[model samples]
Target: MFKRLRRLRLSSNIRELIKETRLDIRDFIYPLFAISGNGIKNEIPSMPGVYQMSPDVIVEECEQLKTLGIYHILLFGIPSHKDSCGSEALSDTGIVPKTIRAIKAKHPDITITADLCFCEYTDHGHCGIIDTKLKTVDNDATLEILAQQAVVLCSSGANIIAPSTMMDGMVWMIRNQLDKAGFSHIPIMSYSTKFSSAYYGPFREVAQSSPSFGDRKSYQEDPANRKEAILESLNDEAEGADILMVKPALAYLDIVRDIRERTLLPLAVYNVSGEYAMLKAAQTAGIIDYESVMIETMLSFKRAGADIIISYHAKEVAKYLLDRK
Candidate 1:
């Protein structure tokens, strides 16, 4: 008797029944860029369809996202001003905090995950304080600022604080500060194994956070190091991270799977802007089907063991899933 392995491939219904991995609308977390202004919804040139919206516009966008069944959003702020210490990130009236309050006031049901990093707030475009003399990011000083940012973000109604600085001991510091500030309920989603990659090129443009002088290689992990990635995730878990992330997901699915095996905490993978832009460019050139490729790429993340997917494609993915239903 011949083995009927082709039986499952015989029909679409059979394929769906045998599928081991599935993508859900709830698995996606959309990212938004919030700028300091009113009635602004400037599209990021490098990332098509992604915009830097004002607080009012952000609330409007969130309402739409809610209708699409995308309740979670990760916010990146572009302040109108910047300083050496990124003081605005800790200010009560800063762009992120102000945007948070606005979103909550209008849509209290949406969950906001604040991206806690100083790169956008600092004039130098580095993730943290710069040691002027040493010509490098001062890790300890950056930790202090990150902690303060976390508290302020939590106070402003952020349901989750995602620290993407890749600084050593940042998770512990933020966790400590949040508890001390009486925000013990807030969870920290640490970017545990962020790689230094060219894939972040488009993101730097959208966030206006490219380093003015040097690359982030000193702080972000090298893409070549697999063991180091796992170690980073382990350390963050020990430091009280509720969720751990592997950034630039397409190029690092192995790292995502490795980290997932090592920790019980939820794993999030960032499908960075460059990845989205590349696919968009391909589709525009008539080289591929945009919708089908987008769904396949997102399912790849889920197949690789990602519990949460943070992507610029979130809105599109949600719509596609809804259409399927």
Candidate 2:
């Protein structure tokens, strides 16, 4: 007798009942880009539906997201000013902190995860403090600044600090600083296995953080090294990361699965801008079914063992799931 798997696939109800992997609103962390202005919602050119919004607009967006049951968001800031030290990132009135306070004031129930990095705030467009003599990022100096940034974000009501710099010992540094500042409860989600990939092209435009001269290969992992990805997650875990992330999710599902097996800590995968852009371009060109592809892509992350997915697709995915319900 043939094992008829077709019985379960016969209808949507049966398929839903037996689906091994499912997408839930709670599994998503919507990413927002905040700029310094009022009433602004500038849609990113490459990322069609994504926008760079001002604080007031961000608050409105947060309220809407809350209504939709997408309780978590990851914020990236575009400060009005940029400097060598990314000083604005540590300011009480900086774009990110201001956006954080505004969102919390309006939607106190929402969880805000601030992206702790200097690239968008640095004039040089590098991730950290640069050593002119060495022509490389000064890792120790950047850690100190990251620690300060973490404290400021937590004080500004950020529920989580996601250090995306891929800096060495960054999780430990931020964790210690948070504890000393009486914010020991704030958890850290480290970008433990971010790769130096060509797939990051569109994100640079959205975040305005492309390096002015060189690439991020010095800090970010080489895309070719699978073993290194595992090591990176392990190191971040040892250094006090509450959650570990694999960036550019689609190309690195194996890495996501590998890291998931190695660590008991929660795993997050960043379905980055370029991944979103490619599908968006195809959808715009009528080359693929956007909704079907988007849902399938999100489910792949879940099937690969990602506990959390930070994606530009979060809002759409959440709405689609709600409609299905």
Candidate 3:
């Protein structure tokens, strides 16, 4: 006897109910870039929808984000000071610490995940306390600073400390330090499969984190390598990362699916700034219908085994998804 499997494929309602993958508003983490100031809201010309907002404007932005049913946010800060060691990264009055305090005071329910990195704080735009001796990312020194940053974020009411510096043993160092600092409840979301790709153009503009002298090929993963992705994810997991993320999601959906096969941890995919800007530009040029394609891109991320999506498009996608209902 032949079995008929086309029954569920007969209609859209049946297909939806039986859908193996579904995207939701809560599955998103909207990324916010904060600069040191009170009222400035600088629009990133390269990335059509993102902005580098000051602390006061960031609070107002959060209010709009909350109304869109988006519950999670990832933060990147632009400091007022920079040094060879990125000393401001550990400062209590740093851009991120202040913004976290302000946002938490206003929107207590939002899951605030602060990006822990020294790139924005370092005058050279390196992501750690650099080693002038060997001229590379000093793993031990970076781990110490990363740990301190995590605790600072936690003290500022950040629920998650996302270390995007890609330093060796960073997750373990951060976890141990947070535990010692009484921030044991805060989680660490490691940007484990962060690739050194050209796809980060728009982010550099939004974050103002481009290296002053050289590139990050020494630390970020090589895009040509796939097995390295698994190794990186495993390292983060073994080091106590609560969640693992793959950056520049569209190009690495395969990596996302592969990493999904190896870990039970919650996986997040970042629809990076470049990807969003490119899509927005194409839509402006009438190459595609922006809203429809944007939603489809997000659905594709869900289908690719990403448990969370970090995107600048979160608010717009949330609105579109809501209007569809």
Candidate 4:
């Protein structure tokens, strides 16, 4: 006789009792884009529910997030000016640094994770300074500025520095500089396995970071190379990253699990803009149940061994989980 496993499947309560993977509101870190202005909350066309909010508006957003019981946020800056070297990123008074200060003042309990990358600040829209001859990013020069950027964010009350430049030795450089500056307690969340993918199209619009010239293929990993992806994350771990991330999480759940198995560090995954947009579009088209699909997508990340999820859908997920309780 066959074992009646259907007995467990019959009741929703039974399913909940035996569920192996679950999503918590605390597992999410919502992403916010801060521009240099007041009363600005311009929604991106491609991404339906997301917006580019100014510092003052962002502070108000924090208040709402607190009500939803979501306390963590990932902040990105959209500077008003840009130079070849992304000098704004190193400024003590730049968009992101100032925003972190403002957020901490009003919402002292909120945890801020400031993103450390130059693409949105640089005029060329590259992650860092470029080589004139090679026409590619100068990795060593970028590392120096990234270190300075990290310290700037930390000094301005950022609890974590997330480096997404995909530069070699980036984690080591930032960690050393942060320690010397007496921010040894601060954690570094490296975007370790970011790939050069088409899924980033919507992000460019909200970030205003589209490359003025060629693509970022030289630095970002090729999506086809699985071994290289794993090695990149492992290297970041060896270089003293406090956390490792697999970006564009849906297409790379295997990479998330692979890194999770190899490292003891907390693993994070980015549910990128394009992934968010696709689900929203399908919902708009009346093709799927948006809430159920979104919950399942988030559950997939938790099941794939991601300890943290940086997602645009974070707020919605938080509300959904709260309602279920």
> How high is each candidate's TM-score?
0.98, 0.97, 0.96, 0.98
Candidate 3 lDDT at 210 equals 87
How far residue 20's Cα lies from its native spot in candidate 4, in Å, is 0.5
> How close is each model in CA RMSD to the real structure?
1.1, 1.3, 2.0, 1.0
Q: What would the per-residue lDDT of candidate 3 be over residues 1-325, giving only the tens digit for each residue?
A: 1246667346987777778877789999999999987789888998876889998998998898888998789999988888889998898888999998998888898889999899888988889877887777788988888888788888888998899998889999999999999988888899999999898988887777889877899999999899987899999999999999999899999999999999999999999988988998998899998888998899889988999999988988888878889
- Which of 3 and 4 is ahead in lDDT? 4
Model 2, TM vs. native: 0.97
- Model 2 spans with C-alpha error above 4 angstroms: 4-11
- Error at 254, model 1, angstroms: 0.8
**Worst ten-residue run, lDDT, model 4?**
1-10
Error of 1 at 194 (Å): 0.4
The runs of at least 3 residues in candidate 3 whose Cα sits more than 4 Å from the true structure, single-residue gaps closed, are 1-9
Least accurate stretch of 10 residues (summed lDDT) in model 1?
1-10
**Residue runs of model 1 more than 4 Å from their true location after superposition:** 4-9
Number of clashing pairs per prediction, in order? 0, 0, 0, 0
User: Stretches of candidate 4 above 4 Å error?
Assistant: none
Q: Which scores greater on TM-score, model 2 or model 3?
A: 2
Query: How much is the lDDT of residue 148 in candidate 3?
Result: 83
Model 2, range 194-272, lDDT digits (tens) per residue?
9999998998998898898888899899999999989999999999999999998999999999998899999999999
